[model samples]
Target: MEYGYYPGCSLIGSAHRLNSTTKKIFKRFGHDLKEIPDWHCCGAFEYGNKNELTDFSKSNLKKAHGFCNDIVAPCPACYKNLKEANQDDGGSFSILHPLDVFEYFDIVESIDIKHDLEGRLFTPYYGCVLLRPKETAIKNKDIMENFITRFGGDVDGEKVKDRCCGGNQFFINRWATEKLSRLIIDNTHGDLVVFCPLCHMALKTFSENRKVIYFNDLLLYVMGETDKL
Candidate 1:
């Protein structure tokens, strides 16, 4: 399977690990993630609220349209913004999340686990952008849980997985964002919290003692591709 990939701004910086692991895993699973040319930020989380007419996301979709009709974004905020742009422009391209592509290829069933997690507890956090507004939501709970179990990790079903990490407010009000991160960290029952890049940053920032890792990083560790990210 092949699709145009949009890494967004975070992928090159805070989420670099996610970018590397995602590309590696996709190649290992016989999928190609070709990056879109002239791709820019998808207006991320704050851009949408700041200006509705500018539509920075349209520039990305327009560039992606030159390459392919389908685009996959690893970041939830990017995925949402791109989807919104496609909708507004009435473009033929389909915006997809990474989980959507994984499901399309049935990635979990196709790969063999070289290492097991030894039943370590993990809590999955689906930040706001991934699940809000219903239409753009990826609905990846079952797939994520199945992936964790296949790697021998037990998904903590008790934790509220859909809570927001207060990513947007992180810059506006640091104290409130830290409080929200604390709430998530305090309630999680696991050896480490597994989530997308933004949530990983929030959880990691507020809780110095707790372990927070990206889902792809955890998968890479389970695959024995690297030692403890």
Candidate 2:
């Protein structure tokens, strides 16, 4: 299936790893992540200028509809914005997070046997944007846990799953944000597997021992894309 792929500002900029790895995994599974033409940023959580986030998202949503009804957003913030646009603008389209796309397509059955995670710990860190407000959250909230179990990783991320990572406030007061992020990180000694790049950044910035990784990077490791993993 060729779905409209929207790479929000973070993905194209600091979160490129998530974008690249997400596209690679989908491509490996034979699903096309067709980027929507002339797509604008999701505008993150900033608002006030209703037109900036809403109008821009609706604009992208319209173009994505022209591409296809199914839209794949790697970033949770982008997914929420796009989904909101579809609903608020009366567009008939399914906005799916990459994790939802994984559930939609049985890529696990298609790929060859890959290296197992071998009991590695994957903290399914949702941060904040992925599963809040109920409206934009994906249908399968257990997706991260399910995927981790599918690859032999232990489910140890729940302790800090719902904890806030101080988000963009990390830049405002570095010490306080670090305190918040460290509390979340210190709870789990294993790597933090997150869907949002902002979450990834917050946890990683203060983490000392534990490696923070995007869900897509974990997929790449088990898929043999790189031996480094």
Candidate 3:
């Protein structure tokens, strides 16, 4: 089952670790990610106009659709934008988040756990783009819980799980982003597992002595692929 992949610009730039770790962890799960050729930005949160965003998202979707009907977007912004594009175009294809892949194919149980993180609490943060606007959200919001429990971890299940991390305003207003990040930090406890690169940056920049790790990197850590994360 080969799926077209869109790594988005962030993954290759500041979030390079996410790109490498996503590939490494997914390969370990016996799946493959064929990156979309001539891929462009999904417009991300840059252009909010409905028409502008649709065009930006559709460009990548069309390219990936040439490769496969099911496209996997590792970045949350890419996932949301791609999902919205598919919907606007008569729902012609599938847009799957990386976490969605783990659950949809039912692959989590198949991976052997190399280490048990007993009593280590983990907070699953979806940020704004990943699970808002219900129509574009992932099918199973609770899908991440299984991995944590199975891998021997505690989940905080914070009510602010879907709160906005103010990524859209990061450049325009640093104070606003910090305020949002502080709100999330005040509500949730334990290490953070974020799917979006911007969320990681927002939380890491404002958090005090807290581990804000990318979801893929955390998977790599629990799998014993690295000596220290």
Top lDDT: which candidate number?
A: 3
Question: Per-residue lDDT for 61-115 in model 2, tens only?
Answer: 7777657888888887888888898889875998888887777775555546467
TM-scores, all models, native as reference: 0.91, 0.93, 0.94
Two-way lDDT contest, 1 vs 3, winner: 3
Model 3 residue-pair collision total: 0
Task: List, residue by residue over 1-229, the lDDT tens digit for candidate 1.
Answer: 7889999888989899889888998887877888998787766665436455237888887787668878888888888878877887886888888787778777777666777887588877776777787878886655677777777788773456777778678888988889888888888767554547778777888887777777787767767787775
Task: Output the TM-score of candidate 2.
Answer: 0.93
Each candidate: RMSD to true structure?
Answer: 2.0, 1.7, 1.5
| Best candidate according to TM-score | 3
By lDDT, the candidates rank as: 3, 2, 1
Please give the CA lDDT of all the candidate structures. 0.77, 0.81, 0.83
How well does candidate 3 score on lDDT at residue 28?
82
Ranking of candidates on TM-score, top first: 3, 2, 1
Question: Residues 50-100, candidate 3, lDDT per residue (tens digit)?
Answer: 898889888887787658888888888888889888888888888888888
Model 2, which residues run further than 4 Å from truth? none
Candidate 3 segments whose C-alpha is farther than 4 A from its true place:
none
Query: lDDT of candidate 2 vs native?
Result: 0.81
- For candidate 1, which ten residues in a row score worst on lDDT? 45-54
